[model samples]
Target: MVVAVLLGSVRSDRVGERVAKWVIAELESRGHEAVLVDPMTLKLPLLDRMWKEVKNEKGSEHAELKAKLQPLAELYQRADGFAIVTAEYNHSAPPALVNLIDYFLEEYFYRPSAIVCYSATPFGGVRAAVQLRSLLAEVGMGSIPTLQPVPAAGDALSAEGVPLTQQLAEKSGKFFDEFEWYMRALAAERKRGTPTGTAA
Candidate 1:
């Protein structure tokens, strides 16, 4: 399956990049195609209008907005699943990540997503993951049951973006197993034109 690994932070010293790299490597190692989607690089402008409004507007009236969002929409549409690497900011997710998720609704519909939540503290950004579950659900995306939480993320990864310990590596493996199962199941369901909520 083609999975999109989202680097959900844009801070100068963000550790989410390292987490995202590790996720991509894991997915590739398992023979899955992984694409990196960085909100920082995408640089999507803050949402000024709701998606429904843009859809209802005339072509010329929303041309600029369409241009900015088309690439992102296409990427998400092609992805069978997603792995969002996020950090908790003030007990919530970063606004940039939220903005990226808000850019398209239909692209995320019926797709499955996994969460890799990391933080400097022991909680490992679980709050952000919890909030993201709700947001992704609203967009008709199902989340894998196993959430990968890396506490003290800066220490959990090596400078080369590899897992620093066997325990961490094992946790990642289990998470990927669950993620892949959902990805394949949902991808098949989507292909067979089966209804969204009918899958196991």
Candidate 2:
């Protein structure tokens, strides 16, 4: 399966990139194709309207908006599943991540997403993960039950983006196992044209 590892933080000196690199390596080791999708690279504008709304509008402005969003749309369409690497900002997800998510709808339909939450604090961005779960569900992606929370993430990872200890490795392994299962199952179901009741 093709999984998109979404780096959800775009702040300067953000550590989410380290977590995303680790996730990509883990997924690739399991024989899955993983793509790194950093919002910083995408540079999507803050969302003000849905695609449908833009399409309905009869003006060059709407056309321009569609053109701008095309790359993001195509990228998301290629992925069978997602690994969302997030950091907590005020007990919630970063505004940029939410904006990126809100830009597309059908691309997320019936897909499975795994939340990888990290933090410098002890709670490990679990609060942000909780909020993201509901947001992803609204976008039609089924979130896997197993969450990968990297507590004291800065200390947990090496400079090379590798997990530093055996304990962290074991925990990440379990998370990957569960995520892969859901990814394959959901991708198969989608391919079979199963009526998931969540398609847009």
Q: Note the clash tally of each candidate.
A: 0, 0
Q: Write the per-residue lDDT of candidate 2 for residues 1-106, one digit (tens) a residue.
A: 8887878899888888888888888999999889887779877778889765675577786677787676667767878898999999999999988887887788
Error of 2 at 111 (Å): 0.8
Instruction: State the lDDT of candidate 1 residue by residue for 37-76, as single tens digits.
Output: 8988877779887565575577697787776666666777
In candidate 2, the residue pairs with backbone N, CA or C atoms under 3 Å apart (3 or more residues apart, or in different chains) clash, namely none
For each candidate in turn, the TM-score is 0.88, 0.89
TM-score of 1: 0.88
Q: Which regions of candidate 1 are displaced past 4 Å?
A: 50-65, 194-200
Stretches of candidate 2 off by over 4 Å are 52-68, 196-200
Residue 97's lDDT within candidate 1 is 89
lDDT of 2: 0.84
> lDDT score of model 1?
0.83
Per-candidate alpha-carbon RMSD to the true structure: 2.8, 2.5
